[model samples]
Target: MCVDSPLPHLDRPFDYQVPAEAAAAAQPGTRVKVRFSGQLIDGFVLERAAGSDHEGKLSFLDKVVSPEPVLTPRVARLAREVADRYAGTLSDVLRLAIPPRHARAEAAPPAEPPPPFTAAVDGLAWHRYVAGAALLRALADGRAPRAVWTALPGEDWPARLAAAAATSLAAGRGALIVVADARDLDRLDAALLRVLGGPGHHVALSAAAGPSERYKRFLAVARGSARIVIGTRAAAFAPVADLGLVAIWDDGDDLHSDQRAPYPHARQVLLARAELEHCAAIVGGFGRTAEAQQLIETGWAIEVGATREELRRSMPRVVTVGEQERARDNAQAAAARLPTLAWRAARDALNAGAPVLIQVPRRGYLPAVACADCFTPARCAVCSGPLALPAAHGVPSCRWCGRPAADHACPQCGRRRLRAAVVGARRTAEELARAFPDTPVRTSGRDGILTSVPGEATLVVSTPGAEPLADGGFGAVLLLDAWAFLTRADLRGTEEALRRWFAAAALARPGAPVVVVADGGLVAVQALLRFDPAWLAARELAERRELGFPPAVRIAALTGPPAAVAELLSLAELPPGAEVLGPVPAAEEGHERMLVRTTRSAGKALALALKTAAGARSVRKAADPVKIQVDPLDLL
Candidate 1:
């Protein structure tokens, strides 16, 4: 029995005796209540054993939770693998893999089998990429063909993904497509309905769905009633039988990273699942990630992208803030945020009766503020948190503590007045509405998000990832305050910035103007101009390799009280060639972080060592627990 305990010391499965009354229901994969440590706890029957290995008598299971088997052997193995890969407990990984039980949903009658589906293998969508058609053919032939696809600008990615899924279903195999979020899932759901001709053939899974609904859909997939599953991150482990194709869209999106323990990325999970299931896989996105680039570099996956000719025809015309524009603005371009050139582009697009898209890095009215006198950052005296203005004339307040900084002064300058340090989507929208008074203006961000907009003469200001889709795509795309993204302290700043730019730029109509407000010489800006995300990704990957950073080497981040961190490192049997970075001060007060690095080849060993040490600490019931994150997204 695999006890549902997250404690690393009790991570292993324990042998249990089944009472004769419940023997019939205590089958492998079924949820059961077992007595562990003198307390009744939930557990899964991994498998039946002929005899007990323990010399002592095995404890009998208290009772079976349900006769219905929710866990599958395949998923159980996948969960175990994920746990090992992330230096996390198997129980934690299992918790992520399986959703909470909804008894009512399980008791409901089984969903009717889907109607017969005959997929039409449309080669039109794949014609742009050289190997795209081949990928579809391989899927139809039930052959696993791993690929890292760079989606073309203005591409109907949902339709393309649906086509791939259709191809796999045609071969009598299941397909799992995990997108970044609900919006993407909805689009894919619609496309699948159109391509497969109905809802029964596929199920859309998301955490946002009501518990009953989510569990119902999950049951459909687990029971093999649904052959295609499309969902957000958690659906990466959806139990699709005879899985043929596993695809992930926008693998670089931070939304794909789980916030819970083990913190497995959807892309990595899908890749690992594909390898385990001997199925085809596709990692397609508007922008590529260094990890995806590594897959291609290591020859584990082939690249599928449009040729130069096709790219030119499909991509919008991209340009950065040029020297002429800067000269015309008298070097006030930075201060203006939206320069004259950007204004002209919006005007031209409006004149053409097409909507324009404006992407802001921040989401509120004024996310950051500074002292007017010395340009020093304004902070809250009580909490030392940066101050922000929620409205045009609103008093500054501490963003962290939420305390009004009515009498705030800059510690550095002792100034009473404050100025906007970061202009966000709301404020940008206000400015645009005033500039284009005659045209309708809309904002999409944290305050209020829009899914789609009508294609007409209007202006749409949005934060990155929240841009609304226009009917025929936006006529122009303006990326404001590029420095906010590029200047972030994280290592993936440039990569993430480029991703946001590409995602926003891809929303423009072919041949439309996409302007980025940044120096033309910057690598990210140049890559955006050329619409070559793969090139930028490759370059970044090479730089990371040279610097011995992630994708080249695996680094485990251990953050906790200083003593706890030191104890973990001392106890861990680090793999050979492991390099320890620092017990540097962490973001949390009185805590520090230490980074342990090792070659990619030693990653598995390193994870095992850490896991063992963590288990040892758990056995000792260490006072302070160290938080271990393998391949943490942020490595400042």
Candidate 2:
């Protein structure tokens, strides 16, 4: 049954007396339909105990939903902790651990075999590698390593992790690697497959993969066949037996967290699994997020760093764009283009027969725009819509509601013309194409364009998620528009922006011009210039510590329906000095959301409130269907 049920806490299991016919099917871990409080609820069979607390008649199990019992003893404990820590329901965590029953089958054949590589194991020294051989030794024993966390930096991170996958099988243990994006997983898998010649060495698992592909990979893990599994966030709970390693690449990426029930992060899940199952964890990234640094600081992990000389040799040329101002027609354009220095750098790289990489913040044509007169974004009259520039034809439209002919005269003014409020990848690509009419400009961005044609004077423009040019290397990386990411009012905005810059810079060849366009005095830029991620992490952590943010403190954001959310807050048992900050209305219309802020002890306090508050008659909240996010990546 769902762990939130009052049965287990009541010190007795309900004697939903099963008949002899269905007795064999009603095994532990088997899901069943049971009548609880006049409602049919889905539950897992914990055990068949021979007792009851009440004198009333007992209910029989509706039937065993599935014969497969996915809830392992180890997973059960971890799921419980995950629920308690996040102030969520056990079923929520379980949902993430186990996929849909229909996805449990193998539907596709194996992929073509990859060629094997012959590397002398003994000749390879540990110092040159980011991953430790000791981790290899531990995974060999079917036991996980207990290192806290030591993040890896550099563009070769994926290749190094692929090498890690190679070590797993030789050690007689399987591997499960989780990354932020499908691109990352594909990169790691391709690198590993280059090392593993066989067809069954690895498989990709993601929603993007067809049902057949996902099913095949899932079956391989569950059946203890596939030794190495690579996927996006969902691969965290891959049922690989004797799991030697669970490497999570770029743990700081928001894509690693599940948006559904339990809201568990792959990094958090890996940490818990490593502790519970005694597996080694390798969380690597171009930038050292505070969460990873915390593991090293707490002595839970050992520090691994590149040599100072090697680091310097691999470092890119750093530049700041915010210090300079452009005097086009002696006035600043509402939509800023590339700084002259950055443009020159790109021009030089192209002149040298090398492609240039430009990183922008948003996608589509004029994603954000402002009024020329009022200097605020133009909106639709009837329904507020974000106005955008016309791309295909001469007609502009509302980007929000997609109202055709959004060329409406502003209600505030009689003027029909609206200025382009924002500069998107599309608009910038078009503008840059116009400026460099002689050069071949192509977009390798989120609009679904993967790569561009290779040419000396090629301008490869892109958005954040669709950063390309990593296959080989870029001659110059133009980190444009510092204000876009820095101005975001989120907790990890700067951290994320820095990470993106570092990753894009890493894609550039050593000593290549990595022109950064940001305020010179900005701490993130300074930190990158110094190539000191730890310094940045520690400083950022200090700010969070003073503000009672995560790492120094744990804050849980509980969100749900309005009346139900409010009722839960009122009935919650908060501790002394702990505070309930908000039942204050959320910006989301019709949603009665609340913020219950407190110390780390708030985990328990919030749990108590949810369990009791869900019992209210008026709300009928259905077991506190609140979304609890711990150490949330996006604080919006």
Q: Highest TM-score, which number?
A: 1
Q: Write the per-residue lDDT of candidate 1 for residues 1-636, one digit (tens) a residue.
A: 899998888989899888899989898889999888888899999998889889998888999998887788998888888999999987898788888899999999898887656756675879789898888888889999999999999999999999999989989999999998888999999999888877799999998998889999999988889999999999999999999999999998999999999888998899889989999999999999999999999999999999999999989998787534553443333333467788888989999999999999998989999989899888888888889999998988889999998888667767798888988888888888777778998999877889999999989999999988999999999998898888899889999999999999999999999988888899999899889999999999999999999988999999999999999999999998999999788999999999999999999999999999999999999989999999999875
What does the lDDT read for residue 453 in candidate 1?
97
Instruction: Give per-model TM-scores.
Output: 0.97, 0.87
List where candidate 1 sits over 4 angstroms from the true fold: 322-337, 412-414
How many steric overlaps are in each model, in order?
0, 16
- Among these predicted structures, which one has the highest lDDT? 1
- Tell me the spans in candidate 2 whose CA falls farther than 4 Å from its real position: 1-43, 47-58, 103-126, 129-154, 327-336, 404-407, 410-414, 451-457, 560-563, 601-605, 615-627
Candidate 1: TM-score? 0.97
Model 2, residue 148: C-alpha shift (Å): 7.1
TM-score of 2: 0.87
